[model samples]
Target: MSPSGKPPRAVDIVRRGLLTRPWRSAVEAVRPPWSPQESQFTQACTRCGRCVEACPGGILQRGDGGYPAADFRHGGCTFCYACAGACPEGLFLPRDGRAWDIVATVTAGCLALQAVECRRCQESCADGAIIFRPVAGGLWQPQLNRSACSGCGGCVAGCPVSAIKMEHSHGRSLAGM
Candidate 1:
C-alpha cells in the first residue's frame, strides 16, 4: 500500500518484485581484479552491476549476492582498469598494488606431464609463464614461472586435461574454484 493508503500500480508491483529477488549468502567466489580482500569487498560493495558491465575483457560476471566476480573461462584480463573506474563505491584498490597473490599452477593431470605431447595451455598463455623444460627423463615438463605469471587464468580453460588452476602462491588454497 502507498502512503496514500491506496492500491499499488503495476509498475510498483514489478519494482517491488525486482527489489525482492532472492539473494544468496556470500560465498568464496573469484572477485574482479584490484578488488579488496573478500571480507572487505563484501562489506564495501553495494551490489551494483556497474563494475561487471564495465569490464572490457568480458571476464566479470554477476556472482553470488549480485556481487561482481571474475570468470576467466572465455579470455584473460587486459588489466585495463575499467572495472575500477566504473565502481561508484570505490571498493577496488589502486591499480599500482599487486592484484592479489594468485598465480597459475600446472597440476599432475597435465597431458605433457604424462608423456603426452600437448601444448594447448602454453598456446593460450599470453604472459609466457608456462615453460616447457627438459627433465631427467628426457620429457619436456611444463614449468610455471611464478614471477611472470599474472594469474589471468587464460591457460586454465585451454588445457585439454583441465590441469591448470589459480591459487595463492604460499600454498594456501583459494577455497572456491
Candidate 2:
C-alpha cells in the first residue's frame, strides 16, 4: 500500500528481486526468445522435479535453487521439446520447427577440459554439431561447428556439471572446437 492508496506494481517487485544481485540481474537481463516462457513457467512451477525425470534427453536439471534450467553446452539438447509437453507449468518452449532456432554457448564443464577420455559430450551430440580436436597435451576440447550442429542439446544433457549453456548464437565459434 502506498500513500496514494494504490497497489505496488509486480514489475517493481521483480526489479527488487533482480537488484539484489548483479550476477543474477545480468543473467535475468540476457533473456533468450524462449526466456519469457521460462521465467513465467518457472514462477508457476512447483519445483516438483517430475519434468526432470520425464526428460528422456536429460537436458533439464534443477538449478542450485532447485528450479528447472536447461543446460545445453555441456552436452546438447535433443530438442525433442518434450519438456514443453510434460511441464505442468508450461515452462518448456514449443520447438515446432524451432529446434535449430536457439543458439547455445559453452562456458563450463567442457568434458574436453575436464577429462580427455570422456568425449561423452562430443559423442552424444545428436546432430554431430560438436567438433572435438586434440590439442596441447593431447587433450580434446568440445567445439560447436555451427555448420554441423543442429542445436539438439544432447551434449548439454550429458554433461555432469551442467556447464554447457544454450544462448542465441553470437555468430562466432569457440577457438578450440
Candidate 3:
C-alpha cells in the first residue's frame, strides 16, 4: 500500500490487466468527453477501494484502479453518483445533468442462459425493467424495458463473465442522414 492506502498488490494486478487488455486500454485512452467537474478529480482518484466501500449498491468498483465501474445487474444507478461524491480524488466526473448518459448493456451471458429458469437478473432489478420472454425455441430471453432502464450499469459488475458493457448513450445516432 502507498500513501493513499490502496494496496500495491491490487493496483499492480489491475494495472497489468489494463496494460494488456487492448479493449480496456482503448476505452481508458479515449479522452474523457468532458473535463472532470473538479480540476483534481481526474488526478486524485487513487483507484483505492474507498469509494467502492462507500457504495451501498456495490455498483461502484475499481476499473483499472482509475475510474468508477458501475454494474447495473442487481439494480440501476439511481444517478446518485454517491461513489463520485465519496471519491477523495474527485475523479468521478459528474455530468450535472442526464445521469443516464452512461448506458450499460448486458451481454450474451445473461443469467437465464446459465440456468433454464433463473431470473436472477430480473429479480435483482429494483426498477422492474428487465422482463423474461419466451423466444423461438421456448427459451426465455431477458429484454430490457428501456423506459424502466436507468443505465446504472450494475448488471455489468454482477455478471460472472463480464458480459455487460457500459456505453455512452447520448452520442451519435443511427438515423438516416
For this target, which candidate reaches the highest lDDT against the unseen true structure?
A: 1
| TM-score per candidate | 0.78, 0.49, 0.54
Tens digits of lDDT, candidate 2, 30-75: 2111434445755777778776676675556676467665554433
Q: Please write out the lDDT profile of model 3 over residues 13-131, one tens digit for every residue.
A: 77777777774434532112222532354465566666667777665555544655444444445555556566566565456654544444556676666555666566656667677
On a 0 to 100 scale, what is the lDDT of residue 74 in model 1?
Answer: 58
Candidate 1 — which pairs collide?
none
By summed lDDT, the worst window of 10 consecutive residues in model 1 runs over 19-28
Please give the CA lDDT of all the candidate structures: 0.80, 0.56, 0.54
Ranking by lDDT: 1, 2, 3
After superposition, candidate 1 runs with Cα above 4 Å error: 1-27, 175-177
Off by over 4 Å in 3: 1-21, 28-54, 61-81, 84-96, 111-115, 157-162, 170-177
List ranges where model 2 is wrong by over 4 Å.
1-20, 28-96, 114-116, 171-177
